[model samples]
Target: MNTSDLKTKIQNLYQDILINLDIEKIDDYFAENYVQETDHDTLNLNEFKDHLQKLKDVVKSLSIEKFNDMLIDEQQRSIFLRYDVAVEKVDNSMGNIEVYAIFKFNEVGKVISCRELSKAYHEELEGLANI
Candidate 1:
């Protein structure tokens, strides 16, 4: 819809869903028809939930290390964002990943699609990132 609304949604996604490990809240941010394309694989809404579950199981903490970019297209309700992610694994090992993602939103403002690329430069993150 609007840039501010989109920004709020993105912030909530990281703070309330990913950082909090609240899988149930995902529906609030993502559409039922959600699909994500990643370098490795494609995931539907159900698969995305499973992926989050796996992350919840293995990740002790998650934080945004750096926010590189966020560009929104108001006409299309789409955005391109790049950020660095820092995570503490269940084993207490630390890792960092750089992620670039494109997200498309539905009329009601739920995320309908996402295509993402992520890479870990450090060994500590390589294994944890697979989940």
Candidate 2:
């Protein structure tokens, strides 16, 4: 697929899958063997779902602020995205943090694997809560 097509896929994942938590839509987008590398560690499909469920349950309001500088390598079928997210904790505290996520697509255009690393700012929020 082309860069534009890949961009649309990521955008849909952000809006429909991540933001909306539409599990039905996920099967259509992600490969059966999809993998996730998060700040906590690496996780396979079931692990990823469990982690996402935890995030969805704990993080009250989750929103992506910006996605910029998306570079796609058609040869390698990989996409690199630099973005930031705004999240409100269950305690009603809000914070924004920078993040980077890389997606590797399979031959059929499904996301085979994804790796995401983000700045840990939850501590900062807790500190502010005390102040």
Candidate 3:
């Protein structure tokens, strides 16, 4: 797909799926055979769905701060995004994080897989001064 098409899909995944927790959106954007990769390991579509469900259960609410950058390789049908994520912590505190992700789409314009890296921090930085 084209850059704008890819961007729209990513935005819909974030806005309609992740944020709203709309499982139905998954049907449209994510292939039923989709998978996810992380530094730790890979998860199949069902596993990934379960993972997101668990997070939704715990996080209560979550949001992406912004999408700072995006690159799409039409030939590979891949899209990369650098984004800032902000969320309400489990303890009711606030947290901000940065994430970079690769979204792999099928020839049919459905996301077939994804891989991501994220960096997160809390108040520990300030405490380190006393250490």
Clashing pairs in 2: none
Per-residue lDDT tens digits for candidate 1, residues 13-116, read 87887679799899999999999887668899998899889998888999885569999998999989999888888999887888899999999999999998
lDDT of candidate 2 over 1-131, digit per residue (tens): 98888888888888877677666677788898998876647778776667667666656776776686688998888999988777787878788666788999998989999887777466644322111
Q: Compute the lDDT of residue 57 as modeled in candidate 3.
A: 60
How does each model score on lDDT?
Answer: 0.85, 0.75, 0.73
The superposed Cα distance between candidate 3 and the true structure at residue 99, in angstroms, equals 0.9
Kindly report which residue stretches of model 1 are placed more than 4 angstroms away from their true locations once superposed. Answer: 127-130
Clashing residue pairs for model 3: none
lDDT of candidate 3 over 1-131, digit per residue (tens): 88788778788888987778776567788888998776546888777777677666656566876789988888898989988766664557676667678999998898888887666666622211111
**Distance from true position, residue 36, model 2, in Å?**
1.1
Candidate 1 vs candidate 3, TM-score winner: 1
Deviation (Å) of 25 in candidate 3:
2.2
Deviation in Å, model 1, residue 128 alpha carbon: 4.0
lDDT of 2 at 95: 86
